[model samples]
Target: MSFARYVEQTDPPRPPRETLPTMYDLPSENPEEPGLPDEFHDFQPELLRITFQPPTHLPEQVFSASDMNLYYNVRYPNWYKRPDWFGAVGVPKLYEGRDLRLSYVIWQEGVSPFVVVELLSPGTEEEDLGRTKRRNDQPPTKWQVYEQILRIPYYVIFSRYTERLQVFILQAGHYQELNLSESKVWMPDIALGLGLWQGEYAGIHRLWLRWYDAKGNWISTEAEQERQRAEQERQRAEQERQRAEQERQRAERLAERLKALGINPDDDL
Candidate 1:
C-alpha cells in the first residue's frame, strides 16, 4: 500500500471518551509480540523507570511517567508503535483512581510525548526509520507517526550495532535533522539531552544514551554518585589515621628524651 493514500483516509477527529479506553490505562507490556532483544527488553524498562519524571505542577499540564505506552488509532486499528523510552511533559499527573497510566493514549491523554526514543535493532531498523510499508489503507509511515501526527518535539534513534545516534527536532510541523557534536545533542525540554558516550551503564559497556548537564558534563547515576562519595570518605579516614600516628610518634620521642635526662615521666607525675 502506498504511504500517501493511508494518510488520506485517516480520521483527524478525536475519538469519544465512552468508546474505548486510552492507551495509558492499558498495560505497558506487549502480549502479542516480545519486544527487541533480551538486553533491550531489560534495560529499556530500566531507562524508562529512571528517566520518567514530570516537571513542576500546573493547572492544565501534567507529567507522564516513563514506560507508558503511547497509542493512536489510525486507518488500521492494530497498528501501533511503542518507543523503548518516552516522556511527555504537559500531561495530567493522575488518571481515574490510579497514579497514572501504563500506556499513553494520545486521544485520551490529550497530549503527545515531548520526546520519543527508539532503541534500534536489526529487526526494527527499517520501521524505526519509517522505511516500512504497510497496507495502502494504513495511516502515515512510522516517520509520519512521529513527524506529522504526533508532532513530538524530539525523536531520537540509537543503533547499538553501529553505536550511532540520530536526533530529529520538530520545526514548522516537520522534523529537521539536528547536528551533533561528538555524538551528543542537548534538549532543554527534558532538562537533559542525548549523547553517545563510551562507558558502562547497568553493567554493559558500549555506546549508550545518557543524560548530561547543560555544560556537557556527564550526569552520574545515583549509584555512581554513591561510589564517589564512599571513595572520598575512605581517603579522609586514612588521612586522620596518619595524623594520629604522627602525634603518637612525637610523644614517644619526648618521653625518650626525658628518660635519657634521668627524669622519668612517671616519677615526675
Candidate 2:
C-alpha cells in the first residue's frame, strides 16, 4: 500500500512513552522559553535533520541520533547543546537496546561524533564561533562543547543568511581554523569531506550541507543526476539528427555532379 493510504487508514495516536522530567542536563528548552528567538523554532528541526544522518534503527524519525544521548554526565551541572548535525563513526549501534533517549548522553555512550556541525544564527553565532566568553556562572560556550568536551575532530558552522562556511579542525587539543576554497573544505579525518552547495533537497532550493567523495567532488543529488541523464539523452538525439542532415546534403551534392557530367544519376537502378 502507498504511504499516504496507510496513514489515511490509521487513526492519529500518541506514542507509548511518558514525558521524561524536564531535567536541564543541557541548556536547551521548548520553544516557549523566554529570550529564545522566533526563528530558532522555525529551523531547529530542519537543521537537525540536515546535520545528522537518518536514524539507523528507526525508519520513522529522521534524527534518531538524538537517542544516542551524547551528554548524559560528561560535564555535570553544565548544559549540553545538541548540534544541528553529528557523526560518531566507531560508536556501538545501541546502548542496552531499550529505553531509547530523546537526546544524546555522552557519559552513557563512550563515543562522540567525529564531526560536529552547528548551524549559525544571530543568537548562536557568537557562541558557536567561541568568540563570546563563558560567563563564570553559565554553561560552556558552543565552542567548548565541540572542542574540549566532545573533542570532536572536525567542527563546522554554516550561516544561512550570508552563505558563509567555516571549518575548525582539532590541533593540539584546540580548534584551529581551516581554509575554504569556493564551496569546499577538506577534513582529513573523516576520509570523506563536507561542504555547502546550492541545490534542491527535500524540494527546498537553498544552500545545504552534504558529504563528498574521496576526490573532493560534491556528491550530486539524486534529482540532479536524473536531470543530467535527461540532458545527455537530448544532446544525443540532436547529434543524430545533425548527422542525418549531413548525409542527406552529401547525397544531393553527388546527384548534382552526375547531372553536370551528363550521367543518369539512377541509370544503374
Candidate 3:
C-alpha cells in the first residue's frame, strides 16, 4: 500500500515513527551512487572543523567530523547520514575513548550533533534547503534526518558561488529560519558564532565559513595564530632596534660635547 493510503486507512492516526521506515531499515550508502565533493566542499568543512571550539567543553570532550557517516537510528543500525561537517560537544574525541572513529554512531555515542553545516552543491541544494520531497518507503532525505530525526540545534548552509549564508535553529520541535543581517549567527550555549569571513584559508583567498568567539572575534586556526604571533615578534624587534639606535645617537652627542670641553669621553665611560 502507498504510504498516503496506509496513513488514511489506519484506525488510529499513526505517528511517522510507526509508519515510516526508520534509519535502520535503510542502507547506509549506495555503491552505484557515489558522492563527488568539489573543492569548496573539501576546504570549507575543514575550516569549520578546525575552528570549532566550545567554551564549556574540553578538547577531549568535543568531537567534530567532516564527511563522516553519522548513524542516527537505533533500530536502523546500518542506516546513516553523512554531513558535510558536524560537531558534538559532550562526546569524546576518540571513539570508545581509545581509537579514532570510522563513523559517528548516535546510539553508541549517546549524543546528537550540536551543529551541522552543509556547503551547498549543485546536486544537493534542494535537499539541503529542505525543498525536496521524500518518496514513500525511501529513507528520509538529509533535511528529514537533521531536522526531524537528529534534531540538531543549529543547521548552517553556505553557498560559495553566491557567498550566501543560511542558518536555522531548532525551536519548539521544529527548525526555524534565522535572519542573519550581519551574515552571522551566535549560539550562546556553545559560546560561539558562525559567519562568512573573507580571508585566505589553505592558501585560497575567498569567503569561507568560520567560527567566532562570543566576543565577536574570529577563532583562529593554529596556523593563523602562529602567523600572528610571528608578526607580533617581528614588530617588537623593530621597535627595540629603533630604541637602540636612538640611545647610540644620544651617547655620540654626549661624547662630542665632552671632547669640545677637552675632557676625554672615555673617562666618563
lDDT of each: 0.68, 0.61, 0.83
How would you encode candidate 2's per-residue C-alpha lDDT over 96-155 as one tens digit per residue?
A: 344444556565455677777777767677887889886655666667767766788888
Cα lDDT tens digits, model 3, 137-226, are: 667678878887788999999888888899999997678999877999989998899998989998999888999998899999999899
Q: Give lDDT tens digits, candidate 1, residues 102-194.
A: 666676666777877887777778988877775646545677888877888988888877878889899987788888766877776655666
Query: Model 2 shows how many backbone clashes?
Result: 12
Candidate 1 regions off by >4 Å?
Answer: 1-15, 18-20, 23-30, 44-68, 73-79, 91-100, 253-269
Which 10-residue span in candidate 3 carries the lowest summed lDDT? 2-11
Clashing pairs in 3: 24-76
TM-scores vs. true structure, each candidate: 0.77, 0.59, 0.87
Ranking by TM-score: 3, 1, 2
